[model samples]
Target: METFESLVRAEFTPKTTFLNTASNALLPARTVAALDRAARLRAEGGALDPLYADVEACRAAYARLAGVPVERVAAGASVALFTSLVAASLPPGAEVLTAEDDFTSVLNPFHARGDLKVRAVPLEQIAEAVRPGTALVAVSAAQSADGRIADLDALREAARQHGARTYVDFSQAAGWLPVDGDAFDYSVTITFKWLLGPHGAAFLVVPKDFGDLMPVQAGWVAGERPWESCYGPVADLARSARRFDSSPALFTYAGLRASLTLVEEIGIDTVRAHDLALADRFRAGLAELGHEPVPSPGSPIVSVPGLGRLQPELAEKGIAVSDRAGNLRASFHLYNTAADVDRLLDALSG
Candidate 1:
């Protein structure tokens, strides 16, 4: 097995102290090289068959990462697009329960329907908020604002007892946290952030029965045999979750395939341990400097209140972080080191 230090050294040469994986992750050199190869193939009129194969390869890899069978995953481009499919499936006036300040993609679709009874509670109260009429419980596995992880086990048990379906968005958790797609009725995750892929790759996992979703956005790629069903209408839509697929961005898949390979090779457990250690170091440093970040134990992302203005100065000092809703957000990942964490602290202290 390759050591984590060597892996980081091999894949990245950061020009700055980058601690912003929550907004966008730095792509590995292998993934970038794959993108260049894909671009060249398109420019030189090479056969397109290999690019199509990349889509399936990426789907299978993401399925394994999410701990689901390949048949359960649908390739898509965005969380909102997939969430809208779930939103379209609900009948008018159905109740949906969610966390306060949950990622909007997990909340907005249900709200946009205007007829659904969408209820929001504190993130800590989500599991307890489930009621008899709640038809769905939608929340992010890890929050985008402060990286507070939801109590998924409690939420799942609560939804089960209340006869509500569960939908989890793993956009902030997949690469660094263990994902069990089978535990929820539906799950969606975009690969760009912690998954270290490009902007145009995402995955959706659905129950084996396909639940109540109607593939309202189905296109040529949603057909069981896409190549043959290109005319007036598809002869047969896919029996599996592939029915929800949008026409893939082939270049995106080509690069994502490589990044997923790297993730699997290093393993999620290893990534989590490395990331949380850096996060803990930063948290300790914050304490020494008389700063208190939002409590997000066991999570790699830290959001400190009343420090958003320091983001610009930090950036000018060759450090990168995010200023979200007046919070200075620093997200650590496998690529980060303790030295990097200390560098940010040193800058903040000065």
Candidate 2:
């Protein structure tokens, strides 16, 4: 596990052995660096120039991580609002395909819209459910409850055959797995989890060219010149995904920048390998204790049914985990190691 450990490990002190990464990641010391950097920026006369630079830096960093052009990635306050914007861009009567268990941020936009037809299907049956009228297929890269990952390739192919766009919520999978950014038309990731950023910052990725697309949420920041004038009309929408971004939060961006830097320095592939290995170890240990988890395709999230009641008790012993839908969920991140898994397993076994 040390092979995968980054120097950033020294900075983490969550007060408990946190296996609740799926809920929210523990903050890193690097966040302080970003905060200090922000302070320095404010100390100077004008903070706008450098704050904006941080925004662009974030866009660039996420773009590089997602393996798409920088133009495709946008700075967002949250996945929920931006996704609503994307869903609203669809024409009236456009059908959106999704699963009941799909993350709220990914599917809620379609569900909330009266004009759009939202069809809910089981994740496994999404391929068969894609109809010709389907405008978009919204799904999570990995299920938040049980850590079951969707087959993006099959989903993309199904959406393609029907001329539909696919939106993937990579909240759980992005920094821990090799996300197929090209397979989907749009993808969203809130950085607090695997990306190790703050709560408010998220990244939204769009394709280089949408054959037919409309802008639903046009804020001043989405214009060609956000700094120029908010009162004036946008003569031209931004050529890039920046068009979706509203006002960027420089304070959150500072922490996000540091987190992205950590992810970059350690490399995502290395982080993924570490995550899976620990997950495998954790599951195997649980199985030995006669509390085998429900079978799942490889995912950093591992869930054990009937353990929800145990979570509160375990936390008292300095072991933190998440409980959802009557299941105890243990989420492994880059910061977790074999030892953390042992601590969790020991708590559960006891």
Candidate 3:
């Protein structure tokens, strides 16, 4: 396997300069080229049929990465959170359970649904909070803000016993961790946050058995036979997750495909190992600087306490980081290196 730094640098385009990837990651050269090719195809008056083919390729790639069948992969935009909401909004008056530390995007969808009651319980209390009337339990495999990882097995058992489905928001964990489809009745949703892809692109993978569960936002393309006729009566809903995919984003799929291909080439396990190594170095450096790093570790995302003013301070020195909950959040991807971590630590020391 190629070195992480080499893999990242080979794909990174110098045209666009990004300080840190945690906020909105910079797309690789392959992704840019693919998108450009797609745009050119459309500009040349190409039909949407060919574009759908490209989208299908991306769907297949994501399905393999997510450990689900292609039929279970649903293409969409930033509606990962929206898809989770639909998954949870099963029956009327059904309560949606989630962690208080969830991404705001995840919470906002259910919060806007007036008919669904939303309950934000602590991670430690999620199992106990899942009751009989609960409709869906939403949990992020890795909490976005604090980088805290959740226990999927525990949450899945809790939801299962209550006769409720579980929605695992894998946005922060998908490309970075190993996701097994058979582990739970999970509708895993993922964005390109740490996946090193375009921002608006994401996908939802629902198990094969949940196809008839009824999606509240079904569209024309969601018809069982979308291509049969533009105005025909809707046929049987798809017997897979594609039923929830109202429409596909051709351009985004092209970009995502390019990015995921690189991920596959480099291997997810290699990426995670490299990131964790860098994170350990970062945490040790921060500890030496008299700041306490978050106790838990999983994703490359690390939080340093009392580094409230570090973001701007580091920015002045050409370093970038995120400030969340009065902690400094630094994320490492395939592009980052030990030297980068050392530079960040040196900047923090000043």
* Highest lDDT scorer: 1
lDDT of 3 by residue, 219-337 (tens): 66666677752565556665567666756678877787788888888888988898788888988998898888776577688887778567887877767788888888888777777
Q: What is the lDDT of residue 40 in candidate 2?
A: 78
Top candidate when judged by TM-score against the true structure: 1
Task: Report how far residue 35 has shifted in candidate 3, in Å.
Answer: 1.3
Model 2: residues with Cα > 4 Å off, grouped in runs = 1-3, 40-46, 210-212
Q: Score each candidate by Cα lDDT.
A: 0.94, 0.82, 0.74
Taking all chains together, each candidate's TM-score versus the true structure is 0.99, 0.94, 0.90
Model 2 RMSD, rounded to 1 decimal: 2.1
Task: Give the clashing residue pairs of candidate 1, or none.
Answer: none
lDDT of 2 by residue, 199-311 (tens): 88888887787424466577788887776647777777888887778787888888888888878888988888888889999889988998868666688899999888888
How close to the true structure is residue 242 of candidate 3, measured as C-alpha lDDT?
65
Error of model 2, residue 4, in angstroms = 4.0
Error of 3 at 108 (Å): 2.1
Model 1, CA-based lDDT: 0.94
Candidate achieving higher TM-score, 1 or 2: 1
